[model samples]
Target: MIRKLCIGGIGGVLCLLWGPSGFGLEPFAPRGELRIVDTSPLNWLSIALNVFERLIEIDIDGNLDPGLATGWRWIDDRTLEVTLRQSVVFHNGEAFDAETVRLNWEAYAGLRQPQMMGEFMNFKPGSRLEVVDPSTVRFRFPEPDGAALVKLGRLHMANRQFHEEHGWGEQQWGMLNKAGPWGTGPYRLMDGFSSSQKRSDRIVLEASRQYWAAKQSPRPQRLVFDNTLSRQEALQSINTAEGPVDLVSELRPVEAMSVAQSSFAEQATKRAALVTVFGQLNMRKAGSPWRDVRLRQAINLAVNRQELLGDIKGHGVIIPALAPEGAFGYDAAVTPYPFDPDKARQILQEAGYPDALMLELIAPEELQTQAISISMMLEQVGFTVDLQVLDAGAFQRQTRLKDVDHPPEQRTWDVALRSALDHLNFPPFLLYHDFALDGPSDWVGEEPELRRLYEEILRTVDREQQERLIRQMERHAHEQASFLYLYNPAQLYAVNKAVTFVLHATTLLPLVETSVTDAHWSVRKISGQEGASETRSAQADWNNAEQVALGEKVYVSFCAGCHGANLEGQPDWQKRLPLGNFPAPPHDETGHTWHHPDQWLFDIVKDGGQRFAPPRYRSAMPAYRDMLTDEEIWAVLAFIKSRWPSSIRAEQARVDARGQ
Candidate 1:
């Protein structure tokens, strides 16, 4: 007889007992298909998340989780060794191993593939990958790279068969071929479903039965991504009872409000600070008012971010710079320019624009509402706005560098509305893409101080030093009014109440985790009596003199800035700051640092307090997982434990021993 056993405990796996053949096995139940709607013709993100797999995957809290590779370690400053997950196979049944990694690496090296961060993302010319074993590979770089993991995370690992048949990039094979582009992700593309058959075509994906993580396999048996309807039509369809669309990936404030009121669907929102919406000023344009720093500063002061937030139904954060809060280089101290139309007018008068300065503002159709709002705000403060709206395709062509030989004077628009993804949360990615000399969107021409700072950040592998340099760039950008800093939009999804979907910060639709609850089977929940807390090790090498010394250096460099030089922490550590966040707490015996286990302490330092804290919680502490090694984190913890009194240490050890 078929039986279901709720084995293990809370947060444990649910297994099925199939006629005594096995005690622990996946439940052979039919998981309903999910239908997702988007505005774009081809939802490449949906396909990428479903069909392809990256070397490393970044979670919602910006932690690097293993994807194809189980784990990775730095062999040295210039070398990195990655352990591949074994017994994995691609959709085409090709065994995934070190050789597959080598082939993917070779494909990247052979072709200058178009990437968001440009050529800097690629490995150095002399860099190479060595296959240490079937499931192990080592990457040797010519020089130390602070962005090795960040770069690796973006590299999608396709099989050798894909490369041999279609090569790299979606344009090469995505539309033309249907059976290929095989990947080892949890889902695979359904056969005979061409991505470019028509504008209304839908891409279908099926869950892979041979997936390595069988227990964590996709809940949805099939995923259908449809781009047939417009955003409004999609919203309308979802409001009705018989609509095929289970989820609308994105919705505006007005649409979201409607969805909230509708009985058929509910609104889901996430603080996705991945994409920053800002106005790109053509400062290099000859005789342009934007060339004057005062005018740029005036533009910033003119726009009322609060008003914009209201327009979006309070769905975004008013960012001080291009980078939002929690992102690298985002200094909380650097506040956004307050809305002051009088000051903006005064600044404009001082900059020789006593009368209204007439300028052209170009924007894509997608950002029409935002563009109009900004134009009206600027017009209120000694500015005459000539707004030019274009389709998405036309706007891309307009912003691109027409002639490399000629200066930026040929550019028509004074400012353009644009949004870019800070996917890695690394400041250098934005700096290199937008501000570097002759960069992709080099509207800001040459600036020596900014360039120098950016270069230093690129070279510096030390996280503390890089943070310092990046802050300097942020300050420089703010002072110079590099771009018209706006706000980071929150991703809003309208979903059917019957279906459950978890939103990702990266705006990726992870259908694997999505599921629909119907009459057949519902989501299983374990009893609260089954232990819910995680047990961690109480061990620490506090007695090691060398380790303590190294930890001390690390503490001084990274922690001392906010936590105090002597580990005394902030004066009012227990109390909340003006921003509603608690100040850095002390690591000494007087504080609660010793109350937690060694592994818990290590996790706090590695992942930061933001992940462990509640939603919308703010913390000044930055995650050091990318910057510091595992050994260094343990050493830092050891150093903290060494400072505590013996009695306090003993009590803390007891607490850890009890797994509290």
Candidate 2:
């Protein structure tokens, strides 16, 4: 016989068959809510909902894994075949087939706007994409692109049905007014998503019950991202025993170290990212000194990398070329220009600048300090540097001087400091995109050798030969001083000790496998028939005398370490550690525990430090979700509040009343 069971609160049922041996049924369990703070906007809410599907995803080691397309093979030097995953359904209920793939790529190619993904797809005006079958597609490129697979990893598929019905652009997914561009991912967007062009500061996503990998999807009931909190605010929240954030990522080096030893958080560091910083010169300007290679070299030589790196702390390393070590085309033999002011002066004098030469420098606001330091260094060798700082947006506009709409007179920036990722993980793409004639950022206009090397690198098929060509290209660019190479900064993040998190190579948060292990308050699944009668309601008041008496015993067992037996907290609680975190504070009237509402305190005890802090903030609080029952936690809160004098307790009651 088959037995059917329904899980209440959650709309789902499971079936079990009775055999001679036994019977079993799968049940849905509630995972606690998660709060995260990220420095960069990932359009994460949309990504979480699986509203779009990329062809490939990068693993933690920076290698590609199949995403939507299960397998791929090269048909020829310029032809490729992709085998799609079968029977996948978009969030909107549309079937994801080869035809869907065709429409999405076509839409991307036909869009009038230039896209970052377009560069990787290598789609041109007449490129051909043919549907070989319902589950397979073939792509024919105009030319052989060695990095084709790498580039396709970023090609996100939009549902063709939704696009056609909405009529494109204005009605496209991710727009503030649109409901979706449904995808085949593990989660779905819940209500209350606020959008912004710069970054969506608030987003909420819920795990999809209908997800294809439902059995393996993480236990998180919901994921929340808030980017509006300032560093100090996040830090403060993290130090609070019951603050609301769960994780903070992309922290600066100093901030990461400040709370490194705090009991509030655990620091996880990835020492390298496939990104670099560099300085580009305007070689196209008429009568410009940068047109002379020797002068550019002198400028590169004048700045002291060691001193500049010291200012950056432990964040980065100076290199001679744009490519980071281990990437294709990086040449170990090519080194950065040694800091020698006298040699730089001699080179500049030979290039006809016997006296001080004046030049303009443009840098983004975030890099203003370093730009100023470099300017001072350049001045020491007889160069007059006029520094101009702009917000990130304005700086990017200035860098796109080669665009047709930009006013010709406004392109007066002589030197621009910029940062970028080697997204394709190949050298020829960078050399061609930034320095070749008519290249995207062709500030250097044209270089015959670099162009020749790029074309040769493209034609070569052997990985060994290709790397050799890359080294030659790197050497050529360094010798020409194509760009003043800087360093690659380390990536950092801070996580709550309660949940396990493994970082991804492309920096995507791995939430699918996340779960509640030793948390203080694990959720209990309630059967539909017995839902209301199983246990006490989550909304019960915390002032019950009996519950308070029970809570006193629970607290002594679980929370008496850092909080002190008398609830006085650790000494010097206000003092911050070198890593930037504070000690545990008292729960009595002397501390600020009573300043929060009951719900806030409950969330802190349930979620721990990650719920209230930014991704970089550190803390020592461990979540009690797995260790304590709701009644027991309430009892503990009641016991603590009973210790407060009537005046303080009354004020806290008012705060809770206002919150309601």
Candidate 3:
């Protein structure tokens, strides 16, 4: 019939026959279309995990898994060779290969792209990719970097055409444009929707029929992410039989409770180990009492983390350090500071603050309750607390030295309550962004020991060695009371009972792995497990006996004078010589030579210590760049590495493979 039907109309009219459900629309089906409530219109979480693909994927337990690339190996300590998966094509019918990777890398290499983990997601400067063939590519770094694969895991791959049209990252609504959101994932951002319309309230995605993995086809034919609905409204929608919403993330405790009691919906919870809420003391502030170790310890002792968790109704674990449990380099031996107000007062007295000590504390506006609780605790410990809360934007600006309007010397806050996400589960990554000398924060001022330890950690890649170094750093931070260790927050999600969802420890919702049961539309159930995948080890270049023998001959001929014939150096090599430079260090297990990757060792030998040494740093070591060829330099390093114990050799090899 040619009759026009106006459905909740402002201006548009539809010419269609009315259906039983009304307006010719079918009833909401969880299996056919999945509606998720998101607070942000960008929907970055879904875009990163579902709409696009990376070179590698990290599982729930922080294990690296294959994604676009099938397998990888370390060509050298600074070069990673990856083999791309064949027969994979993008959503726009573009083939995925080495050229596709190169294009994506070129688009995002040096740009400070906005990411969930901040600017650390960008590849280090001077990092480049080389196409070995159509199916193979190699990544070459300026230096030996241990977090190469972890960084690659965050590189979202789009087709070459998409890169040319929209560029990389969220730049002035570029990613949200209607032209394309072309990717090589199970789903693709549905077109025909204007960027302005999508930015205002909603985004739509559809399952890709031509996705690479046929068996892992997306269950939902259509997916809608709407930000117009509030969490409360989303909860209400889920409780109804034919409501629009099927899933909601980041629910508050009260909302989770409501979902738990609802018959039509259920609540899913997991410990978000990657995100942490902690307090940073402004010990570097000029003439601040927090500079005193005793005062800092007193502050740590005053706060009751368990009580804070209880008050907030949080079901997360209290951490002893910034790093969470199960994360790489996390030490189980370290324990949280006990809550002792009396001890805190005593320490305050010992630190020459016998009377009430006045201090200023600042935190984000969202954490007002936490800030009040901490202030109360400090008040009980004979401290006069001046609590000032700022909005998220202002709080971020004040916390970062570069963004703050005031100069470093003019900063007046004594303590800042901050939150950080160690999404990679790697402590060194966090250290580089927050605690290093060149970091955004001024909390670690003139701390040579901490800076040195961080530098050493950056150069190391062996799991065991990195753990030892990180543990030492943790212990140092703990003993020094560098921060107010807090609990890891638990993330809660509300879901319609028809969907079977699994939660990851990293707080990533695996929508691709989710499924809907048509028979049980109101029966609630949740299940998940954590496991690590086996990683392949790289073959050591020093394994050849001929290379080792040749290396020994070269080492004795050119290096015997100062380094000793048996790989031993002069006594007291750790101490500086009279000329202000240290003597040659031993290459055996007793020295720190094996602590570095093979590339680092080769560079130090080939270019000599003088060129690589710090400014004005005296060095007795001579350059072999003119005397020795590249092969000779490599052979010498191989020979030196071959003399180490099997354990040391294995550790070095592990360091080498970290690049892959």
Task: Please identify which of the two predictions, 1 or 2, would achieve the higher TM-score against the true structure.
Answer: 1
Which residue pairs overlap in candidate 1's backbone?
A: none
Q: Is candidate 1 or candidate 3 better by lDDT?
A: 1
lDDT of 2 by residue, 394-414 (tens): 886777654435553446778
Deviation in angstroms for 144 in model 2? 3.1
Estimate, for each residue in 1-660, the C-alpha lDDT of model 1 and write its tens digit. Answer: 556676677765677655544554563332556677866433564476667777788776555789889999877878889999886777555678898999888877776643534676777789899999999999998988877787787787777756765765633222324443378887776532434334336666666645667666777766776766678888888877534788897677767888867877889898855768889898777766677898899999999999988877898898887776667667888889899999999998998889988889999876788889999999999789999999876786767675334556867689898877666777777544554456677788787888888777767567678788888888888898989999988878898888878777667676666667752122222122125574443346789898889888777645664565678876668887544567668888778888887777887786667778875454546455533556788877778878888998898888777764
Sorted by lDDT (best first), the order is: 1, 3, 2
lDDT of 3 by residue, 1-660 (tens): 223353555632333434332433211212356778865333454455677788888777666789999999877878889999987777544678898998878877646663534565566789889999999999988887767787788777877656665665543212445424368787666532323134536666656545666545676655677777887788788876544788888666556777766777888877755667788877666776776888888988999998888777866788887777677767789988999999999998888889999989999865677888999999999889999999877887877887989776567888888667565677767643475455677575766676777677766545567778888877777888777777777778888787777776666554676666654322221111113342332322678888778788777656653566788975688877443567678988788887787677776785568777875454546455434556777788888888899999888777766744
Query: Model 2: residues >4 Å from true position, as ranges?
Result: 1-30, 39-51, 113-122, 145-147, 164-181, 192-201, 210-216, 230-232, 239-243, 261-263, 402-412, 424-441, 455-469, 508-517, 520-660
lDDT of each: 0.73, 0.66, 0.70
Best by lDDT: 1
User: How many Å off is the CA of 643 in candidate 2?
Assistant: 48
Quality of model 3 by C-alpha lDDT: 0.70
